[model samples]
Target: MADIGGKRVAILATNGFEQSELEVPRDKLREAGAEVHVISLESGEIKGWDLKDWGRTVPVDRVLSDVSADDYDALVLPGGQINPDILRAEPAAIDFIKAFWADKKVIGAICHAPWLLVEAGIIEGRKVTSYHSIKTDVVNAGGKWEDSEVVTDQGLVTSRKPDDLPAFCAKVVEEIGEGRHERRAA
Candidate 1:
């Protein structure tokens, strides 16, 4: 467990997020001493998608228009079929993710959430992993897709699925500890 005390992390999510993907990382990161906030397209709360059904709702800590990459040390993107699909269509959401990359802040995307990465145009030429179903999307986006529990390229971290959340969250904390990375080549 890395001591990320006082570090600020943002978990970008929306309705239909994979239940565990959002909760596990958020809880674990908080337990590791980082201040974690849930940022979404709207205020109030967002519903989650459990393995086979709609799961619990998580309260939003901040709205997308209210924050930026400069407000946090790291950013997290949790995936679900519906969540990323919807978020990827939002220009503001994509720009938020891009800002994190421009600043070289730690960015973590798992499962279908990599779709947001593809939309943000940050995964190109970077090594990453996501739920197997989204492998082609990642590769097509020019990312070096890997079949691994977790992959880290520069300060960007990615994982395959809920089963990989443990490694993903751990690496996120580690990357936050390392601070920002250098910009990637165009």
Candidate 2:
């Protein structure tokens, strides 16, 4: 595991997040020695969506209203059909994600989580991959969509689905260790 002992990571999600997508990466990042926090739209716990039914509930470390991108070294967006959909509609969530992008912080978005990137308008001209259902949305948003298990461009990391979690988590840790990226001007 990569040593990120002093780093702090934020996983942004809401109800309906894919259970494995959130938990697996969170556990791996913690194992790597980074402090991980779950930030959500509300206080208390948020329920996850398992394959065909609702799954586990994760505690909210901080409410979205009380946190800022400056508080963490990296951000993870775990995808579920409904999680990103709800977050994309949220003005605060969009702004928060954009702040991370503007600051060049390491960002990892898997599956439908890329939808939030689309909503934040940061995917333009970048390479990314997500669940096939959202490929068109990503391409339409100017992202170079691919079918790979994992794709990293600059400080941004994306993966196709739950099966890609291992690769996704590894790249995210690698990118975080690389520190902030200097995004090119449009």
Q: Could you tell me every candidate's TM-score relative to the true structure?
A: 0.98, 0.98
Q: Whole-model lDDT, candidate 2?
A: 0.95
Which segments of model 1 are wrong by more than 4 Å? none
The lowest-lDDT stretch of 10 consecutive residues in candidate 2 is: 177-186
Off by over 4 Å in 2: none
**For residues 1-186, what per-residue lDDT tens digits would candidate 1 score against the true structure?**
899999999999999999999999999999999999999999999999999999999999999999988899999999999999999999999999999998889999989998999999888899999999989988999999999999999998999999898989889999999998986584
Error of 2 at 102 (Å): 0.8
Output the lDDT of residue 2, model 2. 83
Task: Give candidates' CA RMSD values in order.
Answer: 0.8, 0.7
lDDT at position 23, candidate 2: 100
Model 2: per-residue Cα lDDT over 119-181, one tens digit each: 999999999999999999999999999999999999999999999999999999999988999
